[model samples]
Target: MNEDNAEQGVIRLLRAAAHTVGPGGRLPSVRTIMAELRVSPVTVQHAMRRLTAEGVIEVRASKGAFAATRRPTSEVPDLEWQSVALGAKPPGDESLRDLLTVPGPEMVPMSGGYLDPELQSVAALGAALGRAARRPEAWARGPVEGREELRAWFARQAGGAFRAGDMVVCPGGQAALSTAFRALTEPGDPVLVEAPTYLGAIATARSAGLRVVPVPADADGVRPDLLNAAFARTGAKVFYCQPLYANPHGAVLSRERRPEVLAVLAKHGAFLIEDDFARDLVIDGTPPPPLAADDIHGHVIYLRSLTKSAAPGLRVAAIGARGAAGARLRSARVMDDFFVAGPLQLAALEISVIASMAASPHLAAAGAEGPPRRAAHGVGGQTPPTPARHDPVGRHAGVGPPAGRRRRRRTDGSRRGPRRGRLRRPALVRGRPAGPAPAPDVRRRAARGVDRRRAPAGRRGRGRGDTSRIVNLRPTFPVVIPAHR
Candidate 1:
């Protein structure tokens, strides 16, 4: 009803074009138009909503918006349709420029509000298309809880300890994560983050009406004493971690310190949310257990995404939760999207999942002597399917494990580690000594783990393909497993 001339002018003309040229006239994409008009997506979305309601243009599900036919029109444009269509000019790089008319050097193109294009993938497009094709209904309005089957799949894939009932799906990690923060704390609440942590988490916290406490971590791991002291000082309720292959530096947490960090959380009576992106991609040693495995009390909450390994476009992430935590997240998701989503780009997911699968072998290889840590909970003994681990741990006596990983024993008795979890290097066996440890302490030389029993004769986990020194990071939060049946 607030349709002033300024608001209606362009919409009226655009609607007229849609009426005459047919819905296939290909109106300017939201991106192209936004850049050209310097309008926000919300503005465009609002206008488009009106157009769709009026039946002037039919918004295609999953695909681009289309002009709906059956509107009364006096005249329809003929030749050079686009030039005269929408009363707008064509854009460059129709693919990308649609988002921005080529941002100036200082502008730093930012659409989707958050997320960097640097990490976006083209494969996501193909995946979404494929999904839309198979599940034609994917383009239609959907359930508030998401496809129950998909949600069930997510629950099933949660680290071994969880159940299908404990899972809830969300549009993205940001939503799931923000919901968690909002549920757990009040405004100005104290929370933990790795120093030089994922900036997005920092931004996410601030935007969600909360406060944060950043913990400093070295190559070995976060300083437990510092964490304990910080908790004593701030008395925070929640702790955030990207333990396994944390974003940015990709540092793996050392085993020696995993328990120490967990102890700090336990002492503080705080909850943990583990993010297992890199850990999921392990191709080398068996995957490690999640920090939630150590949970005797209901304090750990696991949140993972199909996005990192599957495809960001999937906008599909799952919450592996326990007790009241999972329920809180589910409620938040409902409030946010009411379980309703647009024609999902299910196609984009396959690309990431496939890529993640391909990298799995290398991820395992890159880990330490032991297999990757298992999530405290698992899905029918599956290694909690995921992607993104890299190859290397050093001589291979001992290096710190990857980010936030906990510790474990390897098949050949070598060290396997993850966020908040890790293991000691396999000691000598029999009369032989494996070569020096693979990795060195951050302050020392690379001294990796050695297995006199498993080492090739007197040779330790040395040479290529040796994970003797590699360590995987654990996600920042604690994940939990539940009973599905």
Candidate 2:
């Protein structure tokens, strides 16, 4: 073998020997190793040096090599005092940690409202980032309230009286939540939220030292009467709401209830923090205009996020408000990070433009190629699951009615009578028909093995028909129920 391979083999042998010997035990001598492996003294010396460096063995100046002793527990540094200095952790910290925990390779994550890595728009985001990087302005400092074009885009999405001046770009939804909570309310102040709201919102509000009072909400969204009562009871000046596609439960505020909710906010003299994060994720039909769009009186502070609709790394979101609230949001964002990175803002703008243009009828009229259109659609042409219906009661609407309740049809195409039997009991084996036992004579013959097919006399005890090799098929169909038995 070559010198390198010989040296490596010697090291492996020495390592194994070191592990075999107990702590502080003497290992085989260098001369003995050289003699046994039929290698030169240099190989043994090199292996010993490496093992010594690795702490697997120790080589004294005069003494032979020996296994290194493991350090005792008492010799290690103590860290228990840090626990006393840090004090108690905040509530829901563990839950938040669990929520944010990334699933391992073996895990199939079903919980949490996040897009799988497979579903994320990786290619488009990378391309957009590349485009953004090519632009010289993208590397410069951006406005604290974000670029005017991006803000204008957000304003148009907000749809009503919202303008570019009212929009403040933020890092992400959580950061935007933190900024809004800190901006609108003071410490120890009460903030109203829906009963089954986003966990991140709850955690953020609590971290900001605000008392979270839950206003009862159902499938139709938060009840206006309870919301008003909650405001009065808690004396809260701010209410955080998700009118469209509320997280966790995915409830939307009904049209009839929208006016009532607005009236309640006016009655209580409160500001509604509208989280319109999932505005772009429509799977079925068109979503309604944002609640902030309907607010002409400046009671609503609208927050929209692109993190969900776009790739997760595209952490761009906007908070839109009319008057003083808008200014407070802008100031809060400035204090948080001065301003979002220019390149990220530019990349986000690029992605938004591509998505919007792809959806426009004008793009096709411009004679864009099919590949380019599909590429603009995003990674694998996959989009976030945002049901378009105004009031989708979760994902149940997409799934058909339960099997037992399904009605049968007649030959004439009219409705048939109610199911008489146990819904035509399913068979144990898929394609095989289920029925009663065989005739008495057949059963007797089977018991005696008289009617069983067998191999020729000479090959009976071997080959495919060997009794020991034959598999019993009786247990394969475990359950065989019949219509008449």
Runs of candidate 1 with Cα error greater than 4 angstroms are 1-128, 133-143, 280-287, 340-485
List the global CA lDDT of all models.
0.50, 0.62
TM-score of each: 0.49, 0.61
lDDT of 2 by residue, 267-326 (tens): 988999999876655433456789887887999988988886566688888888887888
lDDT at 124 for candidate 2?
Answer: 72
lDDT of 1 by residue, 1-485 (tens): 23354346457656766866775676767886567666666667788888888777777776777777564577985767666676843221121222213332222221112122322344455645666667757667666556666666555454465765676667777677877887777777777776534445656676666666777655554568877887899888787876654543344666777788778878888887776555444423444466666556667777767654433456767666777877777777777767635455244333434335444432233233223321211111232211222222210111222344433222222212211123232211110101121222111111134321132222333322222231211211111111011
